[model samples]
Target chain A: MRKTAEQTAEQTPGHDAPRPVRATQMVLRDTPLPPGARWRRFAVKLVALALIWGVLTEFRLDALYFGVPAILLGAALVFVMPVAPGWRISPAGAVNFALWFAVQSVRGAVDVAQRAFSPAMPLRPGFRSYAPDLPGGAPRVMFLNTITLLPGTLSAEVAGDEVIVHMLDTRADLEADLGALEARIAALFGLNVKSRGST
Target chain B: MPDLITFISAALIAAGAVFFIAGTVGLLRFPDTYCRLHALTKADGLGLALIALGIALTASSFGEVFRIALIWFFVAVASATGGHLIATHARRVDRAEGKEGS
Candidate 1:
């Protein structure tokens, strides 16, 4: 599998086709921004900036003098950057993902701690490659990034469609975990990703 | 209520400290670099997160609480990314050396 991946990487020459790139660029460069969407982005960014300023200044009324222009400058930064089409976020899905992530993070930490503190060290560390079903772009990048934080799994590299993951225990059903995470992330982005069968 | 909050905060902070110690133990005792990375990333990330949560509970203002939460989030991201980079480099070196898992 590594040889095949390296061969494909060579064929691509200038780029590794499936490797994840900055998703922000995809958001802005995918298509020309619509006027209404552009205005909405500006408004949202302005509100977020204002809220940040409010927090930093601890709601000082006098600080509004400097805060307003600072907000404008922050919004201008967003405007100058690439804005991807369909930037709408699913708030409900996001909340669910956050809850799930928190739970998993805690579980992962506990599991590792248990292994670390055990008298008889029980670890079968190994590397495996998985072909991600998520389409190339932000979703893939998100998947790769999210996997690293999960329990017992670390993504070594994302070459083309295959992500090489290092596992603390080879016995664990990592592909299933990856599938569940993929589905949750896809729901957050409102993207439809086909589920791959667990190995 | 103040007493209860203080107790909870102390307990959480102590628990976080325990995790940090466990991570350090694993770093010293684990057989390989990859195993150590697992220990460092997961345990340290959770330790910092628990500490942040404990601190946020006693925060004087909503903004201060949010700041604590933001710090935890950043820590989580940084630890994960940092761990991945180290693990990748280690794996590459292992492969170059024709060690196991190559």
Candidate 2:
């Protein structure tokens, strides 16, 4: 199965094609950003950093003496940083994803706590490799990070499009859960990803 | 109203503390690295989040509340990234040593 994945990756070098890299050799290759897009990203990052500064300093005018330079430096660093392919966030989808994430975090914590307190310690831990449908970028990274917060799953390794997930219970329907999570992330990014079990 | 808010905050904070205890216990009791990572990430993530929310409720101003939330956000991201890094390292070491899943 791993060999087949590598062969396919070698054959395809498209934007959505997964790179044939080992888990340890996972490096984010930067995609060239247009001048207009670069400036837009800088503007967005500057505003975000300024808002963070305002919250941290309680909107104090005197704090701007330090905050102004820090914000500019932080925003300026974006230009030198590798610019990966970006995704557009949908406001409605973000609200939905946030609500779902909150519920899942509580459920995941409660599930672990119950097993920890139980005398039997009913844990059937193992690893499962999943082929994610979301393209390799912010959407895929979000899916991996979010998996750790979901009940009974932690993403361990990523090889190409395959993510190895450590699960507390192997018997759980992980495929469905991963598919749903991927769908939620795709929605959040306004990307139309194919649902699982579909061609 | 302030008194009621205080009572609720205290309750939420106490509940958060319970999860922290459970997380610690799981860390000590779980069989191996991966399982323990699950316990650490999930329990502590929720624990800190609950504590942050509780504290935010009592914050003096909106800025204070946002600051508390920002702390929670940063911690959550850090913990998740840290957990994944540790898990990856352990997996690599296990493979190099010719051991199967932990």
Candidate 3:
């Protein structure tokens, strides 16, 4: 990671000094949750675990007692992981995200399918680095995850704010697609993105 | 009506099969690891989702449909995360070998 980070830093024109990649990006590291939110997340997670229990047990009511302690333990484990700070998801934005995600997944699949079946196998795959405007942590992670599912793009690595992506077709405007997806993700997280036009 | 439902489910399942086949072919034939990862992730993700949808359509109860949806959701998450990890690892290996710019 350090080596790649150095490579990434060197590849960029302005980044002369090699900095620790993901030094500030904490993935389950150190974001203290409020008491109320903590409890709420615990309860919600417990219920989710319970639902999984129900499914696995075929909704047998008798299994609830056995699953209770496990559920509680599982829910408690969530608090230990580093979480995004003050992360709040808008319900409508989430719905939009889901819809867009589904559509994009199909598009990605169809695009690959077409390319895979083509006789010429016209593929000009390459890598490009993108600096997203969203704040570090979950938002960026989510963006990278989404890129993998989107058509013609895969996030090869994420170091600090710079995401190195591999594109299936170099001719395609990947930065534009990343920008659009980043905006959607920002809206979903309700993050106030700075320098809207520059991205 | 039941026949129509069966026909739709069958079509969806067949379509899912086609996507899966494409994904496997891409996995085998693609030039590089990153490109193959693209093929595998995208095709398998959609193929599994479509298969799940077909199963949901044919499910006898709402609970069964919900279960199928849950399975599909998990598959989607796993594929996305797994694909990212593989691609990142591949990139790291490539850079380590001093074979940059692919």
Candidate 4:
């Protein structure tokens, strides 16, 4: 099922890449969650949910009556659900990415604000397709989300390996920006960075 | 110290409001849907971050601060996702109308 869908996606013409329908199919076809990982996820989620409940209820002891069962149910749902492959986040890389994202978000906002306030409204908007080196999963989704927060780029669609980006200014060097972001994301996810070929 | 904190918080929040105004203006004035998505996502993301930081500073308890941070995190995710969805829909509509890369 997955093989045929991917082949069809690849064969489709460039101008009209079909909307991605693989996520639900993947969920259906996914292997059973490993016992160790399942327990680990349950434990972590239980603790996190407990903490959130404590905060929400201001840590009243009486609230435990409701919170305990609710939290247990919520965390146990993880066991029954198909686990999407998890990304192993690097702590140092996450800190670095967060700092970079914060700075770039400010720059992105300023860039748009300037254009918005300008009398001439200088915008050279166009779509450019990029083939990401990152695999089709969490890393690619993160990269796409990050593009919207970066300076002058918004991800319009993702058809297979190709992501169509809408640029506020077509003159900007998009390859450099996207490449830098992909590298940062790769580091964060502890994945090997691959050099992207020319699109 | 409290006075200084208050002043800083007020300043940050005011700065955030300015960005929100800029974002709204861009949404109104931009020539097309894609450009407007750029304006909405970037400006509003930063604007909310600044505002949330300012509010976190003023929060009375650590729990309150954590809650504020969580709110900011969820908003950031939602805004990014929403922007992408809107852009995808607009692109599809345009493509259907035989407009490519406007």
Candidate 5:
């Protein structure tokens, strides 16, 4: 179904996740993307891609194989990306912390895998919500999904900025994770994140 | 043929990213809820398709690359189906809450 752009955005929530807030005045930020900021984000994306391509080049000696695609891709993105409008890039601090979240997800996933195969599985299952500190949609989505990848918690529901998560264990271990999680999300989202030990 | 493949793949990926950025912008710039939703899905579908092709082009071994390309296709289909369902439900919720006009 070739729906129009207007048709796609106005549609419903994508998953079983909580419905997005209706477009209220509160959700709209006055600080729209400035021209300079847009340029900077484009620059960052370009540099990152170039660096990745450099790595690819080191691995593959066939310049004729990769150069054409990389150059064309670079040129297309250079012109196309800066103008599209949505590229909301977090600052360096936030980006750094977001990477940390990815690492945390891997750790949580490993712990989960270990427990899943263990003889005496230390499992606890429950649901809880926490206030979100991050602003934009991507970070919040990334945050929730990454947390779900963690061993014990799957983000079952998100209401406004409050995410209701399901976890196997809600004890001291979970408590410790929440604190670190809170700090990490707070660092990334800039929202006032709070937790009463997962409840 | 290789040149054509690379050129087309890169073009698609770049275009996809552009759409994604556009969607993100639309989500912010659009006046109401439904309008923003439209922005998101359009970007999501096209952008993903483009990126998957681009990645497929970068792979060394044909078999491994082809496998990953299949994964990308599956992921695209899954997310697209999901976005459609969500959009429908969202519209219903909006209408019920008198948010349809907005």
Candidate 6:
């Protein structure tokens, strides 16, 4: 039976989630080198990461002193690391979060500096909770921390993925921004949500 | 060449700090809840990223730098996740109080 829209919104991610898995099935499945595949991928990723670090840090591979450690360390992690199969190398959420981070860091710096030496500083403070228009769990946690990072907001507490934030001023503006946030997050998640409360 | 990188990293770090300052200042100054959130989340992820990148400049080895960079990446992800969750909660609160929404 298809669940109604309202029912889905209230559902949280957990063992009882719709996509429950069977332990026995996983164990019996003829997944060849399942563990081996995971290890190989992990090792390859670390090696690639070392190369990237080399470029960013401008470290010459020929430099034995530092270069060798980088290779050895990376390889060691790949070979000996204890990562589970369900874990992902690059989750979609992380990628989207990066986008927000780059844009906000620059904005925060500029905003804070201007207020510091300015002749007049306009400020407001209040406590309020918002029913966000995004998915629960990970996205919700990000929202709370992000609130803390801005000029005058703090995430107080979260219950069932709903966020409570403190704002110095501009609640309406923040509200709109949150609306836009929902849209952006939706895009990042590839979720084709038509309206709020769609999960 | 290393010196050049150091200088750039310093500049970036300084820049990120400026954003953090502004974010806090905005938090102190903004007139309303919605606006305050706007002030913070945008700056939060980016500022943290720049600061992390700046520190990674002096990493002892490539792997160290890579690890540092990865941490920065995590902060960025955390910012967005935090933003959305809080927004959702805010909406619910507003509704309870019979308030208009954005």
Best by TM-score: 2
Cα error of candidate 5 at position A51, Å: 1.6
Candidates 5 and 6 compared by DockQ, better number = 6
Residues forming the 10-long window of minimal summed lDDT in candidate 6 chain A: A15-24
lDDT of 3 by residue, B1-102 (tens): 999999999999999999999999999889999999999999988898888888888899877887788888888888888988888777666665668754
Question: Judged by DockQ, which candidate is best?
Answer: 4
Would you estimate the TM-scores of all the predictions?
A: 0.80, 0.89, 0.86, 0.87, 0.44, 0.48
Where in model 3 is the C-alpha error above 4 Å? A1-32, A35-37, A55-59
User: Backbone clashes per model, in order?
Assistant: 4, 0, 2, 0, 19, 57
> Candidate 6: where is the Cα deviation over 4 Å?
A1-97, A150-152, A159-162, A196-199, B1-3, B16-48, B58-60, B70-102
Model 5 chain A scores worst on lDDT over the 10 consecutive residues at A17-26
lDDT of 5 at A199: 43
CAPRI band for model 3: medium
Worst 10 residues of 2 chain B by lDDT: B93-102
Looking at model 2, the pairs that clash are none
* Chain A only TM-scores, each candidate in turn: 0.72, 0.83, 0.78, 0.79, 0.56, 0.48
| Separate DockQ for every predicted complex | 0.52, 0.48, 0.54, 0.59, 0.03, 0.20
Q: Which ten residues in a row have the lowest lDDT in candidate 4 chain A?
A: A11-20
Across residues A1-199, which tens digit of lDDT does each residue of candidate 1 receive? 4568778766643344333353334434456756787678788989988887888889899999999998998887866765555444588989999899989888888988999999987899888888876654466667877887788888876554578888889999988898899899888888777878976
TM-score head-to-head 1 vs 3, winner: 3
Question: Residue by residue across B31-74, what tens digits does model 5's lDDT show?
Answer: 44433433444444445656776878876776656566667656
Whole-model Cα lDDT per candidate?
A: 0.79, 0.86, 0.82, 0.86, 0.54, 0.58
State which candidate, 1 or 6, has the greater DockQ.
1
Could you give candidate 6's per-residue lDDT for residues A14-71 as a string of tens digits?
Answer: 2132221332233224324465775577677777866765775576656657766766
Chain B structural similarity as TM-score, candidate 5:
0.66
| Model 2 stretches with alpha carbons more than 4 Å out | A1-31
Chain B alone, model 1: TM-score?
0.94
